[model samples]
Structures are given as structure tokens and as C-alpha cells.
Target: MESPERARLDAFFRHVTEQFPAGAPVTSLIVTHLLSERPAFLRAMSATSAVAAVLPKPRSIDQHTLEAVQSLYPVHDLSRELFADSTRALDYIEETAGGQDLVLADIGGYFAPSLSTLVEKFSGRVLGVVEDTENGHQRYAALDQLRCPVISVARSPLKDCEDHLVGRSIVFSADALVRARGDILTSRNACVLGFGKVGRAIAQTLRAHDLRVTVFDKDPVRRVQAHAHGFRTAATTTEAVRDAELVLCATGNLALRQDDFAALRNGAYLASVTSSEDELELTPLQDLYQRVPVGEQLTRYEITGHYFYVLADGGAVNFVHGAAVGTYIHLVQAEILAATAALSHGRFEPGLHSMPAADRQAIARIWLGHFER
Candidate 1:
């Protein structure tokens, strides 16, 4: 925990503390995935703001992360985690706001579609939300009406840096899982669903490994873009998985469901690097398909007289080992911090907003100074 990134987060957050102060202590509900970098980030958040509660994303919490965040605030128990039952967590943390205007710094949109009642309960307004991931952004965007302004760093260029690197970490973990199964990816067929930043990186990395990579995206433009990038394009998810030995889902929107899983090649290695939605739809598989764990590497499933394997048991494979994607992730985390600064100051109206380009550039400049120096 004494690494340079801790110092870096402190400095980055200190810069934010100076650049934008709320004129009073800002009460915040932080929904975060507990990676190694999180404690430092949260500690810095506590140093600069009034924390209502610290909620961990289930499956991402580890013992070390738990120990680190334990002393910070009322870090919620994972058994009834925020994302699992957001309403209850919201109800519990509302008291901590002390009737002050509460702001949310969310990782996934845990409070989305569920915050109106709680916001109405607050004597002070629920100022706004700062969302970090595309999965969460989509959730908020889908809402026809929003309670407050939403500031998103998910589409920021700074976040794109994290997304691209996330793809590498995902491939690193998935390759390890495949090797754990006594196999390799070379000379094999791989299908990647979704051709956004992460999916594009995954396809490119797989090609570098000499895999025949095919990509499918519901957006016709992205499918064409994938084809232009020299990857084979599939017209449907079933078509994409029909012949590939390895299938990865980069879309957070449950790309592969029950019927889709029925089309996967026998013994295909399946993984997803997105949010906690089980993008490959593995829950019903337990009832419909026979599941057996293959040690710590992958879970084997039987469906349609064929077999398939899931890495990290249908969770994010990027963290199958750990969530560290080097010090670069702090850049994205810093942008999330900056979004909170906006929330504290009431910087937007009741609409969705991307991270300000000025804030994005300032964060990068600060990041370079913090790390390069």
C-alpha cells in the first residue's frame, strides 16, 4: 500500500481539493469496485469530502481491500451490498447525510432508477451523480427523465485510456485461464462481442496472438468498422459464437443469453470484462446446463449436447487474477474524482454530461506530473 500511486492519488486529489472546493464539506455515497488502488482513492476522498457510505461492488471486494477501507467510514457489508439491493443501501446511508444535500459518486449506476424516493426524503437536494462506467452511463441515459444532473467520465478520452488498457488486462487474465486449462489461444478461433473501445482492443490483441478473430456489434457502423479493421464480422451473437473456440463479451448489456449460449462451440472458453450483469447469462445455465468447476481456472457447462467453459464464473475475467492494470488506472479514477468536484459545486443542470475536457486535460497533466516526476 506504500507504493507511488498512493502518493499520486493524494497529490491528484489534493489538486482537486484546491481547484474546486464545495465551500462546505461534501457528503457523498461512493459505489466502487474494491481493487488495490481503491483504498488510497477512498482515503483521499475522505480527506477531501464528507463520506456518507462506502459501498463495495460484490465479487470485486477482497480481504486486503476490506481491511483497507474498514476504518474509513460505514463501509457497507457485502452480504447486502448496494448494487444487490440499492434501495436498502440508499435508505441506510440517507441518515449519514445528516439532512445535508447528498451527492453520489457511483461506479455502476446503483442509484439510477432507484434514487428518486431517497432524494425526495433529503431536506437538501440530491445534487447530482458522477458515473464512471459505460454500463452505468447507459443505464442513466435510458431513463426518460433524470432526478439531477449526471456527470459521466465513462466516455472521456482519459477513460478511453483505461478501457484500452483494461482490454490488455482482460486478455492477460483470459489467456492465463486458458493456459490453466492446459490449452493455448494460438491458431484458434476467437469471437468478440461488441466492438467498442475494449472489444476493439481485445480483437487486436487476440490477432497479435495469431487467433482468427471475429467481431459482432449490434451497431452496423461498428460491425463495418470491425470489418474495416480486418476482423471478420458476424451478423448475430449466435453466428459469432457458432465456430469460435474462445468467445468474449465486451458489451455490458447481457450479449449472450440462454438461447445464444446454446449456439457456442463445444468446449469454448467464454469470458466477459464488463460490469456484474453476467453478460454471458450464466445464472440460468446452472439450472439448464450442468456446471462443474475446473479447479480455480474456469467453470465447465453442458448445453445442447455440447460443453462450454466460463472464466471467472461469468464475472469480469479482468479481475480473475486482480484489478490492477498498472498505475494508469489512476488516471481514470482521477477523472471520476473530478466529476465529484462538479457534483459538489452543482456544475450541471438536470441532464447527462460528459467529463469536461478541461477537467480531463488537467487530470492528465497532473497524472504525468505525479507519476513522471
Candidate 2:
């Protein structure tokens, strides 16, 4: 009997193939963190038989797992540094692709300084890029004269599902933290920075856990929405950090800086639910604190007569600590595959574009039907 995960993977692939015929010859480049949860996607893409190269995130997954997946498809594991070093990444792409067109990437590919240059150098040979993160979506907005169409999953309505998963993961991470460090979350004052979908979900979850939650967002509209939702809204980041025992940064932007760190009360715990480490601005704190390992996923710092705790080294706490999003990622992955099909078979104008609503609905319907049963 097929496993449930395999069954769902097959169903998702069938759905994509129905919309866009598979086996159409194309060359593609994929840059993403290679987690144990990614094999399903690798299998789905292999079914298309696209000539592909992968630049997995540095040290994200073990070489044994990568080797197993590579055996199933003609995938070249470009150097791990490729994702961080854009010039090297682009050079490898140029050499490996040898004129193949489609590019699919997560945060790294979207924010690479050489992206615009790659599109220009490849010219009409490139189909376009499919970006899957909020940080990438923000970076896409700043690019001037993008040469090819950009399909952004971050902008799609399907992101609500992703945010919901993030909220669930945050709760799981919070529970783990409580178990690791007792009584920190029980009726304690906590602040969540940002009122975006992820942040809103987190605030709700934290409140559900009986933590007094205060939400802070730079946008007045979001602040008003938080108030409407019956959550206290902080006027400034400083206000949110002051006296809060727990803080979560979900803004996907730099929400905390040097001064904000200075405001943290002793024994305060900070974690980033965002994809990057920019959430807490730790550069200036490097010299001020003596780092001590608390656990595999946490660090304790002695700074200025107080102890500060950071979860997952100021990165996505749930992910770094092995709290899997599990099947919630299936729908998001389906959306990505559907977007890839659309970009391969359809034409798109340059600039950021949401996944077609019809495609989004179709993907959602499949997952909803399965879960609803």
C-alpha cells in the first residue's frame, strides 16, 4: 500500500500534469533549503524530466539524503556556497544550464544581486523566476527593469494557509520552549512584532496559550486591525520590548536593533519566526555578550548584568528546532508546482505577479477536500 504522503504527492502531480502536460523538455535551476520534507517535490519535478540543477542551502541537509535524491533525477548539486555567493551561483548556472531557461528559487535566488544580470545575460532564453518567500517578494519590488516575468507565491492568496501553518508551528515551538524553560509563557507578557498574516496568527496562538500578547506593527492600519481583534497594540518597537518576557519577530524585516536589544529585560527570550536573522540585529551585540549554549536550539548570553535567551540563534525557531510543519506544506508545495506549470506553458509580463486565482483555488480545493474528509 502507498503511504499517505506518497498518495498526496501523486495526486498533486496528477493535478499539475492535467493543467500543463508534463515531459515537455525544459532546463531549470532550483535553489532552496534541502530539508528531509523536500523529497516529494524532488519526485514531482523528476516526473517532468526537466534537466535541472539544484543549489541546496548550505549545510541544510546531510549529503547522504542529497545523494539519495540525486540518484532519482539528473540533478547536479551545485556548491552549497552558490546560494550565498551570487557571482559564483550565476557563473555555475551559466555553465550548467548551457542555455536552459526556467529558474525556481526560494529567498536566495530572488534576492541575489546577480539576478537582474542573469536575466539580462540569458535574455530570451529565460522563462522567468518563481519566488516563494516574503523576503524575496519584497526584494522583487525594488528591482528596476526586470527582464522576465516573476511569479511570486508570497503574493498569492494561498499564503493565508502558509501563515496558518506558521502560526501552528509557533505554538509548537512555544510549547517546546516552555518545556525547556519552565513557566516562562504562563500568563507572562509577550510581544509579537509585525501584524502581517504570520504575525497575526502568532499573536492569536500565543494568546490562546494564555500569554498576554501585545502586537506591534509600523503600519497604522495593521495596528488598528490588531486593536479591532481585541489585542493590545504597541505604538513602537521599544514599547513592545519593554517589560515583555517573550518576544517574537515575524515582520520579515529588521524589527529589533541595538537599542531595542538594550530595552530587553533580563531573562527575556527572543525568537525569530521570520525566514532570516535580520529580525533581531545581533551584530552590535556580538562584542557585548559572552555566549553560552543552553541547548541545541537555544543560546544564553551574559550581557550588561543580565542574561538574554535567543531561540534558534535568531532564525526561524520552529524550523531550526525540528518542529515540522508536516502536511501543511503540501498545499503550498502544490501551489509552487502549479505556478511552475503555468510559467512554463503560459506567457507572463515582467514584474511581480500573483499566482493566478484559478490555479490557487484549484490547488486549495484539492487539499481542502482531502483534509475535510
Instruction: Provide the TM-score for each candidate, comma-separated.
Output: 0.94, 0.89
| Model 2 / residue 202 / CA error / Å | 0.4
Which pairs of residues collide in model 2?
none
lDDT of 1 by residue, 216-315 (tens): 9999999999999999999988889899999989886778877788888888999988654637666667788878898585888976688988888788
9: Cα error in model 1, Å: 3.8
lDDT per residue as tens, model 2, 220-292: 9999999999999889998888878888898876889877787888988888875444476886878988889
* Cα lDDT computed for each candidate against the true fold: 0.79, 0.71
> lDDT (0-100) at residue 267 of candidate 1?
82
Worst 10 residues of 1 by lDDT: 77-86
